[model samples]
Target: MSAWDRTTSREQVLTRIRKLAEIGKISDTGVSRLAMTPLDRQAVELARQWMKEAGMSVRLDAAGNLIGRLESPVAPDAPVLMLGSHLDTQPYAGRFDGIIGVLGAIEAVHAFVSEGLVPQRPIEVVAFSDEEGCRFNKGIFGSRAMVGRLEEGELERVDGDGITRSEALSIFGGDSARLDEAKYAKGSIAAYLELHIEQGPVLESLDAACGLVTGISGPLWLTVELHGFAGHAGSVPMSMRRDALAGAARIIAGLQDLVRAEAGTPAVGTAGTLQLFPGSRNIIPERVQFTIDLRDMDMERRNRLEAKLRELIDEVAADNGLTYSIREDTNSPPRYCDPELMDVIRLEANGMGLQLPELMSGPFHDALALSYACPYAMIFVRSKDGISHNPQEYSSADDIAEGVELLYRTMRSLALSIQGERSGGKWESTTA
Candidate 1:
């Protein structure tokens, strides 16, 4: 309110991404920029040009993560103030998800050059690869390797179409063989920050422009298979017919009831995908399979839900004379952001006269994965509604720019603080 003017001029970054959308540069489905695809390739190249245009050196790592390095007044090897977000998006996904963070970092660099604001440590902006997990079932592939967490077996995970990880890498113009090389030495990085759109309607509903992430919830992908005998619906008596679909239908209803009854206040579950076998009107359907997606910030609750689901699946399957099996396709533990860094983010936002909410993230993101590797945090900007991963997803240019301003201030402050430490100097903790 007091003449807020510390914000950087980063309209160009927003303009560039919006321009990409205006043209056929984006996919037909509102947001279809999958990693390593032609669109992702174009996006990375654009990032490279912007990095140079912003007066920073640019390079790509083995895992296809793009980096732009800006020098600081501190030592050449000063602990870097790394900021990043992914460039790839979900099929027909929204514009802001991970794209904003990457370009916003570029905007931060441009701001430094334009305003002649030099911090103590160098700043490195990155665009991580394969964050959406649309093409590859595994997500945060780039960040996982960055943290030295990708086991060798993961390299063997073939995609849906029988494309090996190595082949997919080559198709994307990167070497899958060298993904392990993407790992960095522990403590080599000083800190990391990311900016993303709040995929939920929380901020927009609350009329807040910016939100600080306290934690990101874990996601559990589950597959439930129910098997029973195929038979004629008219001839086979209810007692004689082994109705798999019937059993599945009952369990599906039960699954919803269980979630509604026991789920943590805000926790939810979705049986998004379902398949019935042998589409014949008369014949009783034999096999039924469906997908379950469970999300929660509390790991214990997630585990409990999973356990209860397994028991329910077994009980219902056996009660109806059906065969069934439960397997956890994938699960990531909940990630908590650095509390001290979060405080600094809040302080910076308040100093800038921006209102913010301390919120937990419901969606899984690359930032959650990277938190394990660094003192990482995220800033969530308001979305039009709670809608994301669709073409209708939107945020105003002014709001986007405001978040960029916050990103810049927090990053610069961190760099200067690190530099101050290395030089045996002190930063005056100037919030604004």
Candidate 2:
């Protein structure tokens, strides 16, 4: 039997997930482990213990990222192959969103040790911090810091309770002032791999056990303001009134129409937050502000959609007699999966007799941030009903096991290939 087959059992994996889920258990049904919270710290401590038990050296980075390192006996200074995912959870998030990836990685390393196999490159599993952004309203804090992309001003960002990110980092045992120490130099990491739930319905709808991510969609956030003259609701004639809310509504409708037209494509748009000035029933809305979140896997298509939305907004403002302003808050470009890493996943799935479908992730992940520093790839298990970010999010144990097995196989293959490249020998797939 293969080392993958000899890894931890499905029940063991589920048990670990359950233990982590209990850390921030908000109710009978959900978890609330926001980053830098007491529960978040507890979860990290537990992960540190697990990593130690797996025979790896573990430490917390300056950004509070939990990193477990297993050095290769032959080549201790080789570029590390990194694995794992975020440990933070959304508000009332389900148990499996980020938990599975971290635990699965620990299990993979344990399997490797159990088989007494040593590769040429070190393996590092990192459970990144603040991925949900529920507390500070900014995501990928740890990964961004690791790549040296974190802005200094971001450390001063205050949460709902007025705790600055730096303060929270200090409480969580991280030195925000020393985040530069967390940055990994170029060529320090060979690649990054993560196994997470699909968080969507595509794989479940097709009854597939796993998916190979093609790319991660990047989100473009826009804050739009429409201004018009406030009029008395009872005295103003419908034709004479310049209603900002009405103009905002038209623009939102247009956005929906445009997104619908591009439904089968990678484009998606959402107007999740809106506010009207003087929110009174009898007052005409003089100003309206709304947030638009648009995402796409292709940067060209995403930019085109942005242009089309701007054009539609201009038309809506002109037709409604309202002056409009748009401010782009964020524009994150899409991260395509590394082709060679993707092929390794595909070949491993085929070797294991598992059906792995290719799918683009609509939701962003830590892997997207890691892509800036190294070649990154992800594997996704099917989520039940494609639900995520909710207490109802779920994936079956059988499917989770399949994903973990695939992850182990992929890591094993990468290790062998790294060793082969170092020794000037052809790499052979262990799965074959």
- Most accurate candidate by TM-score: 2
Candidate 2 residue spans exceeding 4 A from truth:
419-432
Q: In model 1, what is the error at residue 387, expressed in angstroms?
A: 2.4
Model 1 superposed RMSD (Cα): 3.6
Candidate 1 residue lDDT tens string, 140-246: 88877788777657767777777776776676666777776777777667778999999888898889988999888778998888889998778888878778888
- For all predicted structures, in order, the TM-scores are 0.87, 0.95
Q: Put down candidate 2 lDDT per residue, 1-432, tens digits, no spaces.
A: 465653345767888898998998987668989999889999999999999998899999999999999998878898899998988899878999988999999998888888888866899999998988878888989988998888758999999899999999999999988998999999898899999999999998888989999999888999999999888999999989889999999889989998898877878899999999988999999999999999999889888888999999999889888998999999988889998889889988998899988999988888988899988899999999999999999999899999998898888888766535544533354343
TM-score for candidate 1, residues paired by index: 0.87
Estimate the lDDT of model 2. Answer: 0.89
Candidate 2's clash total is 0
Count of residue pairs whose backbone atoms collide, per candidate: 3, 0
lDDT (C-alpha, whole model) for all candidates? 0.78, 0.89
lDDT score at residue 301, model 2, on the 0-100 scale: 85
